[model samples]
Structures are given as structure tokens and as C-alpha cells.
Target: MAKRRTTPKELPDAVREAVDRTVQATRGSAVQTRERAQGAVDDLVDTVDDLVKGAEGRIVRGRRAAARAIDDVRPATNEDMRELKAELRRIGRRLEAIEERLPAKRPPTTRQGAKSGSGSAKPRAARSGSSAKPRSAKRGSSAG
Candidate 1:
């Protein structure tokens, strides 16, 4: 485009003043835009730095959590195992002592006429009215 030539002296006072005001306004707007852009850059940098710190904190926490988990599942030392075994043996001895104090169980009784020479262990049922005693009489009492 060709530049229009005009002398400042020939221009009207109002037109010159209006042109100056527009120039000043444009310069002010440029300065404001630059400042706002710089502020946005600074804010963005600060946000990124905060994000990095948060991530580092999370990483540290994760490492600590992993260490705690390992400790929880770590194998018992020899001393610990020995102590556990000793405790179990002590408990077993106590249980055996208690069992020894209990009375022995009696074997089931058979019919009086059962042959001892037969050597069979099974019990035989007596007849309805035999010389052998009734089951209820030999045993203690009946539920019915």
C-alpha cells in the first residue's frame, strides 16, 4: 500500500489530538498485554512446581508404605521360631497332664453266656426271656 503524505501543520488540531490519543491507547494496551502474559507464565511455572512436589511426596509415601509391607511379611528370626516351638511344647505338656487325670473309658459289656473261648469281639443279643439279664437291667437306665 502507498503511504498517504500529509503535513502535521495542515491537519486540524482536533484530528491531531484524536490520532495522538489513539496512539497512546494502543501503546498502553500493548504494555498491559505483555504484563498479563508474563503473569500467566509465572503462574503456570508455580503450578508445575507444586505438581512436581506433590508427586515427589506421593513417591516417598509409596516407598515407606512398601517398606512397611515388607516388614510385616518378613520371616521370623531363629530366636522367634524357637520361642514359638517352646510355647507349643509347654501347651502340649499341660494338655497331656489334664488328660492323664481323667478316668479311663470302660469297654462295652456282652451277654453273660457269651463264649470266652470263641475269641470273637462282637456282642450277642439275649433272648426275650432268657436266664441272661435284660439289657436295661445290665446297663443303667433307658431313655424311654
Candidate 2:
């Protein structure tokens, strides 16, 4: 007896059509997802651009305000400084005039020994322990 070869089976038409539909649906979903993602990225980019422009505008405004503030303050501060300098100079001149009018400082007075032509005064001796003499109540009678 000779052996026979068997042929491979093909999928049914309905099953093949179902698989084809599923593939087409998946491809459509992928394209839609890509388009949505691109739109979100563009929107994000636009939002960032708006934020940057807003920040730039605020910075410009702030800089202008600061410049205006400095301008407003500069003259007043300069005038105040000038007045302070003038006042200081006037005070210095007044002090100089007072100093010139004041009496000159005198030399310190000499010690008694130096004035009397004596040698340096000697220190007193320490007293010995002794019974003190009684004091009289009437001062003039004691002196007499």
C-alpha cells in the first residue's frame, strides 16, 4: 500500500473577514491617537508661549516702574545729601570759630613741695600700738 499526502486546511471566509475588520479598526485607532497627541503637544506649546509673553510683559513693566521710582527719588535724595553736606560744613565752621574764641588751656599747678623748694615729701611712718591719751571735752581748755 502507498502512503497519501494530506493538504493543509484554509481559514473560513467569515473568520478572515472578521480578522481583516479588526486590523483596520486598530489602524484607525492608532492614527486617531497620534493626531490627538499632536494636538495636545501643540496646545501645550501655545500655552507656554503665552506664559513666556506674559512674563516678559510683566518684567518690562516692572523695570519701567523701578526706573520711574528711581527717577522720582533721585533729585530728592541728591538735594537731601547736598543739604546735609552744607549743614556739616556750616557746623564745622561754627566749631572752628568757637574753638578760636575759647580761652587757652593752662598748665597744671605744681605740688606744694615743688613750689616751696623742698625735696620730695616723705611718707608718714606707721604708728606703734599704744594706749591713746584721753581727750578733753572742752576744746579751748585743752588747748590752754
Candidate 3:
């Protein structure tokens, strides 16, 4: 037998409101309700997609910038390596001091997830062995 197909998802509250607004906007206007509502919904979707794309682009640029900042480039001479190491060491101490002063980071837990108490199935469980360490942290710190 063929697998049963499910109906499409119910409209979210915001989308429902958008539909209502669209309906209201088009009501007694030159355009049909469904057509104008479709246009409004399409416009909203396009706007949201643009926002997401913009954020994604910013994230990509930020990641590239951060990668560039943290990456070690080959200098002309071994003498430059010494200066680089010293600078790295200074950065390490500064980071350490900052961490010491800052609050200890805890794993995030949704209230429902915490209430469920299913430790193995939690989002934080997935992140446990993930690479969220400071760059200068030793390999030994890896949970794996």
C-alpha cells in the first residue's frame, strides 16, 4: 500500500493575521481577495526571505572575517614567527583573564526539554562533544 500523505501545515498565527490583513486590504478594492492576498503573502514571504538571506550573508562575511583574524599566515622570516607567538601568548592571557572574570557558561535547555528530563535526547546533549571551545584551548579539552 502507498504511504499516506499528510495535509500541509496549519497557518501560523502571524500568517493568519497577514491573511486577514490581506483580505481586509483587498476587500471592496479593484483586485480580487485571493489574488491580492496572494500578492501580500508573497510580498511578506519575499521580505522574510530577504531578511534571512541578508542575515546569512552577514554570517558568512562574519565567519570569513573571524577565520581571517584567527588564522596564522606565513611571514617572511622565522623571526616574525617569534613575534607572532608572543602576540598569540599575550592574546591567550587576555582571553584567560576575560574568561575568569566572566560567568561560567552553561548549556542551554528549553523549559520543556528540561522538564522531560530525557538527558540523552536533549539538544544540549548533541552539543556536548561539539567544537564550541575557544581557539587557543588544548585538544585534550575535546570531549571525544
Specify the highest-TM-score model's number. 2
lDDT of 3 by residue, 1-144 (tens): 999987556657678899999887877474576778999999999999999999999999999988887665634477878889989989977987887899977876567546565556646635687756555476457564
lDDT accuracy of residue 76 in candidate 3: 49
The predicted structure with the larger TM-score, 1 or 2, is 2
List TM-scores for all candidates, in order. 0.42, 0.43, 0.30
Clashing pairs in 3: none
lDDT of 1 by residue, 49-127 (tens): 9999999999999999999999899999999899999999799678768877989857876669988766555444442
lDDT, model 3: 0.77
All predictions: root-mean-square deviation over Cα?
A: 15.6, 23.3, 33.1
Select the stronger candidate by TM-score from 2 and 3.
2
Instruction: For candidate 2, write residues 11-126 as lDDT tens digits.
Output: 46677899999999999999999999999999999999999999999999999999999988876677888999999979967876887799986764666556574533432232
> lDDT values of the candidates?
0.83, 0.77, 0.77
Candidate rank order under TM-score: 2, 1, 3
Candidate number of the best lDDT: 1
On a 0 to 1 TM-score scale, where does candidate 1 land against the true structure? 0.42
